[model samples]
Target chain A: MSSKAFKQPWTLRTASSVFVIAWLILAAFPFLWTLWGSFKVELDFFSKADWRNALTGARTMAEHGSSFTGNGYSGAWVQEEFWRAVFNTAIVCFFTVAISLTIGTLGGYALSRSSYRYTFWLLITALIFRAMPPITLVAGYLLPFFEWNLWGILPTTIVVLVAINQPFTLWMLHSFFQKIPKELDESAKVDGCTQFQAFRHVIIPVMWPGVITTGLFSFLLAYNDFAVTSMLLEKENQTMVPKIASFLGTTQTEGNVMFAVAAVVSATAPLFILVMFFQRQIVSGLTQGAVKG
Target chain B: MKHKTFFWFILPTALAMLLFIALPIVSVITQSLFTPHEQVFKTVENCTPFKCTQSTTIDQEATEALREAQPLGRFVGLSIYLDRGHLAFGEVAQAWQSRDGFGDFFNKIGNLPFYRAMAFTLSYTFVVTPLLIILGFMIAVAVNSLHRHLKGLVIFFSLLPMIVSPLIGSLVLFWMVDSRGVLGTGLQWLLSNPDLSLKASTGLTWIMLMVYGVWHSAPFAFVVFYAGLQTLPKDTLESAMIDGATRWQQIRYVVIPHLMPLVTFVALIQLMDNFRVFEPIVGFNAEAHAQSLSWFIFNDLGGETRLLSSASASSVLTILGVAILLSPVLIRTWRDFNSKG
Candidate 1:
């Protein structure tokens, strides 16, 4: 607000910018490498004689490759399997987020408003499940369920994910609900709303950010899950990440370039899409909803 | 009437939780007791045609029959727990080495890879958590001090990492850290030209792992801290500023004290998560010496023997570890909830 404050040169400003730029470079480099690696060809990968040469000469191979070589970036990105993996990831994420949000919110609301014995029990149970090791649950039961015809690929994977995700969401939402003061409930009732009506009309709007954050977390957990998805899904329903992982040890070893590229693309897509669609809600959601007062 | 309404409202969630969460947990705890010793004895009895000899009676068979005849309720008691799994506590206590399982469980644990993996997992969590926390605090403070619009923007940008799928993050990290990729390539040249060898367990590989972890995890902590910062009393902070408190002074005296409750809360959740970490290690380098308790449990449970008992014992141990670590926090929260009620 004063000219005297501005009199000191822009040194701090410049330094801050430089710092931000350096960190961003380090942080964003892996993503850039992934994007570039996706467009590279296999022969180009192998021609370099060794790892170092391959690292340096990958660009050169890209330049000299045939128009429709079908050997490098083009082959991997444009394939049906790639699209299938993407679809499976979407299916898993969508259902996982949607179901997790519903159950968590409903349970959170009940626990928030109701003073019942089972509410405390439910909360504790949810906490225990939230802390349960995901690997043990999947390993011990997933295959056995399939063997006994209690599960199918898509359904089993979905249920396992839903179970894994529900506890965290419940805990998050419950905490969020706890933060909404009892005065708001009283005021809503005073405004002539029933208990259900009060929760639906009043509490829902207030907890929208919490819901969004919890939903986003659920989405992230489901989407990024490697071990559970790898264990549960049969060949046809195998998700994208594990498919790329499977590519690592095969004769198609040179496929690492495309895998890197795809990894960058895949990693950036969901978060980018989420922020783009729900920027406001996600921002406030992240801040006010998670660390309950 | 009030109690009735509350009961009705809580019923659906309580029922679903009981059947799913409560029942499964109780089953896991109960199943930790029953061994397959009975099943083995039954199979042996049906398979053999050997009849009892008067003077030369088989003590082993008689003991096996006694074990078989033991009640299932007693199985839920101490006896069942004693002989429960492939790696029973009873057997493990008797054996000199760790391998008390029927077959290769000892050899499996003896392998350098398993211990190396456990070390990796511990170090990864140990290293990443503090970095993430510090970065989160810096970002939170920076964002908290900005003008409203910019503060909002910073919060939005920081949450970007949290929203991405974990699968995607690990894959992205794998590519960047590969020998021929960006950072990997830079380091490869440095190593090769200088006659340096990049170790699988060290060199660029571990650095890549740490960076990936810090980048991916910082966002969650940042968002949570930022929110906590917002809820802090503005008047106290303003008064501190007016009283000639430096930013650091204000943070130490005003901000941190305000944030302790939340900091502890986030740390507890993160600790539980870090303790059971599976995704990054599993995704980044499946065979890369990175094994946490969760991964070990999976390996044991997935083996040919499917030693659910051993897995159960391990699970119980993990749960106990978590309970011990969080008992203070849990007790405090429970008390707070009760007082509020």
Candidate 2:
């Protein structure tokens, strides 16, 4: 791909480099700044006198006797009991991913293998479902959930999230399954294996790459969700994102905004690691739908 | 596959979507038409002395019984949709009759809660979608031009904003742009307006949200466009260059035509997403200045007295808006599928 014709003149190269650098800063700076500010005292973080105080942790020095402090982390984790939300988040993400992938794999594989006209309709239905904002559905859930005593529980929220995630998970996995050769499964079936057995034995082994990618996305949908979790979960059963939101209500007046900041950083850490490890998969997953279009 | 086998295979997901996604839309529509029962009132007369006063009191038992009997409340038809909190048909008529001009009529309409949210949602969707596409294309081209070793690092950093939860991403930016925070102070210093506050003005708040929207979604466009660029026909590009076309001209003619489908794809997805922009309003604490339709519904549902009817009406409207926005794509998909089949 690298050819002599592709070579850029100095001015264009400089401009491109400059633009990329500027974009990189815009992309990465806020997270970096917030991570730095999370260690500082509130006064220093939202310093009224000078913004540089945040960089230097001037108030943090006066208050905690250090430029770097774990006070916010401790306050959020121990004092605010943010670890409970973390635990709940772990449970929700794990279960949502597991269940979504289980059902999504079956449905997606069936859609890909079948030649029926219904398959197209089902995929289109999923697309329409995907586009409906989850919040609109939340309004529907509240009444029924309250009546059935299904409100404010972790399991209910997990199921709701899995349901909300199905449209996307099905779409992604269906595209992926479509890419695999039909002969792989058809050959296995000719040996007299039942459909489920064929999928279980032959298709399952090779399906991991696609499953893992879909699972990553399911985990993200559950993890990054605010609307469904916030509305559905009980206060005690609240996940990290909603827990952070709840902090704004209670902690703002107490001058403990740093607790929220610390919690935000803590919640983001796993995603950071996920992206670091699964960069290729994440990129491919995002482009999968577009490529199909 | 046999129909029975297909049914068995698809049953679980089908049930989930039907029960949760499909039924909810029905529930929302039903709920939208129904208003919660007004508190049952009883006028009780108490005679003590010469002059006695009679006061009307809410009949707790009756109201409780009423609510218990019919959990969905009394059906109000489309009244909720036409109320002041929603379409405000009456108010629009009044405004139209009294308006000096279109601007004045629009000003009145803008004051309505539903219209206000619609205005912001539409503006944000239209403004952010194109800007993000252009910014994303530029970034993709730039990153594609970079040395191979640096490409991974640039791509990793670029994906950060999009990958982070919209709420957290916006909160991070919101903190920075707080009047006392870094960017806020930087802007003040640049403009030489010590009193300038981004949050305090409507125009600035709208711009801030749109900027955050673009920042958050651009990486998605970049990644898709980048992938499209990988499959670009190098021979065509070479031929264009050989024909005395400038680099820009080659991109204009060759590169863009190849990526046109991807651009449509990105724009369609972005339109659907940006229309439902709710998290940033909460994250930025910008609800006071800007309210999106989703935010409007969230506000109704989250309050102490959940305005179920109001929220449901808004949900129905929002769903209709989505259907309208997605009709073109749906029709196109249907056409393509029919042709292929």
Q: What DockQ does each prediction reach against the true complex?
A: 0.34, 0.82
Q: What is the C-alpha lDDT profile of model 2 across B226-283, one tens digit per residue?
A: 9999999988988898899998899899999999999999999999999999999999
* Model 2 chain B poorest ten-residue lDDT run: B44-53
Give native contacts recovered, as a fraction, per prediction: 0.31, 0.72
Using TM-score as the measure, the top candidate is 2
Please give, for residues B312-336, the per-residue lDDT of candidate 1 as tens digits: 6556655665667567766876887
Collision pairs in model 2: none
TM-score of each: 0.76, 0.98
The TM-scores, chain A only, for the candidates as listed are 0.76, 0.97
State, as a TM-score between 0 and 1, how close model 1 is to the true structure: 0.76
Query: In candidate 1, how many Å is residue A66 off?
Result: 7.4
**Candidate 1: lDDT of B234?**
69
**DockQ for candidate 1, C-alpha atoms:** 0.34
Runs in model 2 deviating more than 4 A are: B49-53
Clashing pairs in 1: A34-A261, A41-A72, A224-B166, A224-B167, B117-B291
